[model samples]
Target: MQAAPTPVLLSSTPIDLSPWLSALDSVSAAIGDIPALLSLAVEAGRTWPQPGGGRTVVLWELLASVSAIDVAAARVLEPHLDAVAILSQSAQAFPDIRPGAEGAGDEAWGVFAAEAPGTRLEARSAGTGTVISGTKPWCSLAGSLDSAVITANTDDGGRAAFAVSLRHPGVTCEQPEWIARGLREIPSGSVHFEHVPAVPLGGTGWYHSRPGFAWGGMGVAACWLGGAVGVARDFRTGLSAGAEGGREPDQVSLAALGEVDRTLTAVLQYLARVAARMDDGTLGSGAGQSTWSEAQRVRGTVAAAVERVLTLVGSNRGPGPLAFDERYAKRMADLALYVRQHHGARDDAQLGRLALKGDCPW
Candidate 1:
């Protein structure tokens, strides 16, 4: 008789990573799924920032990996995390960033938005030296931010970005009034800088011209993918609980959940492939208009996937706050707001604009 074939087994299990740190301690001594593995890197980046490697892809990968985690983590980790590694890593990730004049300070990059009705940050330059002012709405690493990348009307009457130190007596982080849904873990508060001394990272128009200006968006697609996994986990948990309670996971619910899972999975593949291309130098133009267009499409897909999950889970408020079934509500709220950074408005508009130009490959 032929020896019994090894049973093919599959589990829809989620691993609690807090317990396992090394590859040796990984669950079942097996490589965890990409989502879980990615999450570790993301959280690690947040809790243990590598300050010196600022210009390396590793720095941005860390940031982008955990970019979607709420602001709360940003605050908690600010004190404990290895900040020096983060800066050093960022410098390496984007080697183009320059050290300021001896007295001039550096600024932290945050993603609230552009073309918004706000002036949380401002910067002015005279020759090589620059003075920055105003408040930043959502400075990601604000508490520990060396400074804030500020924009303001110059004396000559032109808009500009200036690197302003947060330690300066002129700058202050205010209460974050509108706590958006998703990335609440970050210290996304407003900051006001008054006559803060600063230095231009590049020439008068360097910051805007940086390749990362658009690269940031594409990298963040991974975060959305993470959120999608979170949603999937939540969905599965809900279904299991409902099943245990003898409630059948209706067809509509299963279908909705599945769709969200499939769509998000597709985009996740897209992000990973494109990211690899970027690493390999296959995908040219990090911050070109085309990059923006593709990012928008991915963002829209993520948004839709989240919304589909929300709908499948139902909207009727259940007993107490915890009892309500808002499947991915918290995450969705965060993603809805975050996705706009790709310049995405509606589901259709994601690839709509791109269609006008031409079809895209995968």
Candidate 2:
């Protein structure tokens, strides 16, 4: 079946993402298969536009398109693309860091940067290089992916990013007994690094300080937006089917659909504006408070919009689809868990603080 057309960002130069949509559609049925998803991510990493490049909009659109197909695919693909972007930024910032030449081959990569209490990954100088040791938590697909751009604390009390091979003898990936119903195929388990050799990507505290960090966060919002779109699509499909069956949607359902369309349209426009700003350097490259505030705003807005979409979809469609349609049910569950990455009220409070400090654009 032909893939549904991807939403085009409002740009002076129109980009044709139909090819990517078609490619993702070909493997839509194998959504939960790790190998197939990894293969697609590798292919996309080879040709997809890097965030903050001139084609930032295209990069996000591709992410959203993948999410629209399956949230699990986005779960696997977003971090891979983010890893590529991080490596690219690192290479630009540090002359000695060569992405491909630094033992980071053309294999599938993930970003394992999440840290947990009482668990730490330390990066220490080992002769002319560095090695990371300890446990890194929330490492999604760590066992399956070939490499990762992980963050580890340094001896100087600062954190830095390193590209390390997951297949090394010093590395141990724990089997995840993940009980989460959503994103069941993609397990986020911890990996222990026993002095695993690593190539430093950038200088101290450069991973989270880079401007691309905010851009990457916004890219995740794009995935949320896309997943919501997928849910909204199911609602639309149900409405159309009902109409064809001579059971037209009532005023309440039509109003819910209208609200969904309005919310998605507003978020899409906001994302386009942010992407353009990022590409044109209007968002600044210093990872300033303003950049972070904008990212927080985008994430919070998208998260709220997604929540509304899920609610509308549930209320309008009732429990029939949730109970019977496996794909739709999975989409709903995956998106609910995925958008929680936004941190909801905590993020809103951060934004509130930023606004009070005059960091936000109002």
Candidate 3:
């Protein structure tokens, strides 16, 4: 396969991700193979750099590269990497809560922190430790992954993070009838826990109130950007093929490609800048107003750019690729659904509220 485009440089000492990229490319063909993805996640957990540990850019570039290969694979990989980072941070913040060898083991981990209305996961004190019960919504690959870094409502009515093994007898992963066309391979459903043993990671509200939370959200945006890059790659290849076939592209098609190029360029530059700030500690280390506003801005920017690229590619390429080219079609569909994680207007409104409260850089 052709070499992937070089990731945007965020540090003077560039990271050599070619090996990891090759591994990801090899697994792209087996898009839905949970075992292969889990194995890769376990390997990555041992080698991938933690966010804000001076190689934040490397972490995001790795995520983006995976998405560029296969969105579903990235969907399975990103959270595992994020879970490792979370565990690393939690271990440092509360040495007493260190996950010991389990955190650094061969197990594949996931972050199941999404909440649903009327559903709750509660953590209660049991003996000298803690246990969690109730159902957690939007838990992707819950049955396949070995463990997860979960958040639950604590006895004090505040949310806290914990590490729990999914192998526990009290855990039941419900298989839902997932009918989504995009990301069909990655099934996201609810998981029910009944007094499953859990190890607390941080104090109440530390999970959401940590700076890594914002960083992790932006890392997902990087995946969205990478999915768009895959679509853009298809668009470029289609134009070239047409030219080679004596059907020279018209001005409209070239114009659409130009628009895609500019949009992706701007977003890449933004991510690089943000990653640099995160590394240098200019963005602050807490989940305060500034960091929260910046996260919203980065996610909003990348999401908008992904949307624009999707529109340009779909409208310009027409239905040919969508109907005939499987990879291109999958990339387009996956990106459309993945970018929706940004929450569009609601996120914009949140950013607006932060700005009104003097949280924005401007």
Q: List the candidates' TM-scores in order.
A: 0.63, 0.95, 0.95
| Candidate 1 minimal-lDDT segment of 10 residues | 4-13
Cα lDDT tens digits for candidate 3, 283-303: 854444477788999999999
- Per-residue lDDT tens digits of candidate 2, residues 212-326? 8998999999999989998998899999999999999999999999999999989998999989998898884433346888899989999999999999889889999999999
| Candidate 2's TM-score | 0.95
Task: For model 2, give the 10-residue run with minimal summed lDDT.
Answer: 6-15
Model 1: residues with Cα > 4 Å off, grouped in runs: 1-97, 100-115, 118-122, 126-128, 135-144, 152-160, 179-189, 284-289, 314-337, 340-343, 346-362
Cα TM-score of candidate 1: 0.63
